[model samples]
Target: VYNISKEDGANICQWEYWGGNGQKFILEPVKEIEGDVNADGALSVIDVILLQKWLLAVPDAELTDWKAADLCEDNIINVFDLHLLKRMLLEQ
Candidate 1:
């Protein structure tokens, strides 16, 4: 079972039955990828491809966690984020 609450006093409760066909869940904090601007687990050519897609305005719900990609901590993910990621990778 899981309960989600918002700051406005609204809440939602949901439960999953214990069965092979039932849903499963894994909870974890968003990781700080060393230089993966696209947050796909690693900094690689794939990350660059994903970033290019995002820059072209692709609709990706997974990339909504801007904090993981906002490498500069400027509160917005754009070319600057990519630059920061590049810098981090170069430093390594």
Candidate 2:
């Protein structure tokens, strides 16, 4: 837990670009597919278990396809991502 000293909010910034001169934005390739953490061509309890294990720093529990596991697209695997995975599994 954390205690706040005084301020209860923070500021955010946004940027807009009107035009560019022959410049392009390149996107990094995503993982093989979404939610196939173990690369078994499917999403199952084992996939969730493997992802959880990876997050827990379990040896050899590495995610075969991290892009798929990073369902939130935040470039990180966290509890929120875990929740997304669960929702997907439930929906199936």
Candidate 3:
């Protein structure tokens, strides 16, 4: 599953795609669009907060793609990442 669907959690599980000819295509694992942590189809301050909460374990917070959250590309998500994300938001 390369492209995630709009339905919440729709792309976050195994799926079976049925073809018109009665063919079945099975895909494993969840597919998350990069930078769409909340999966709302856009990067926003909410995403930043979600990452923050996830790092702090503030309950019910989550990050679907650590790769996307690692803004600095340092293989870690920390306050530094938050700063980078903020900077990116500002630049955009």
Evaluate model 1: give its TM-score: 0.49
Task: List the candidates' TM-scores in order.
Answer: 0.49, 0.63, 0.59
> Of the pair 1 and 2, which is ahead by lDDT?
2
Question: On residues 1-92, what C-alpha lDDT tens digit does candidate 3 reach at each position?
Answer: 33544434544445476443223346587665455567676788888888889888898787766677887778878888888877877777
Compared with the true structure, what per-residue lDDT tens digits does model 2 show for residues 1-92? 01212233423223354444222344477446578888888889888888889889998888877888889898988988988998898989
Q: 1 or 3, which is superior by lDDT?
A: 3
Q: For candidate 1, lDDT tens digit of each residue in 1-92?
A: 23333234444345655543224444579667755655567777666566667767877724634566777777777898777666666676
Candidates' C-alpha lDDT: 0.61, 0.75, 0.70
Of candidates 2 and 1, the better by TM-score: 2
Q: Given candidate 1, what's the lDDT at residue 52?
A: 60
lDDT of 1 at 4: 37
Q: Which segments of candidate 1 are over 4 A away from where they belong?
A: 1-31, 37-40, 59-64
Clashing pairs in 1: none
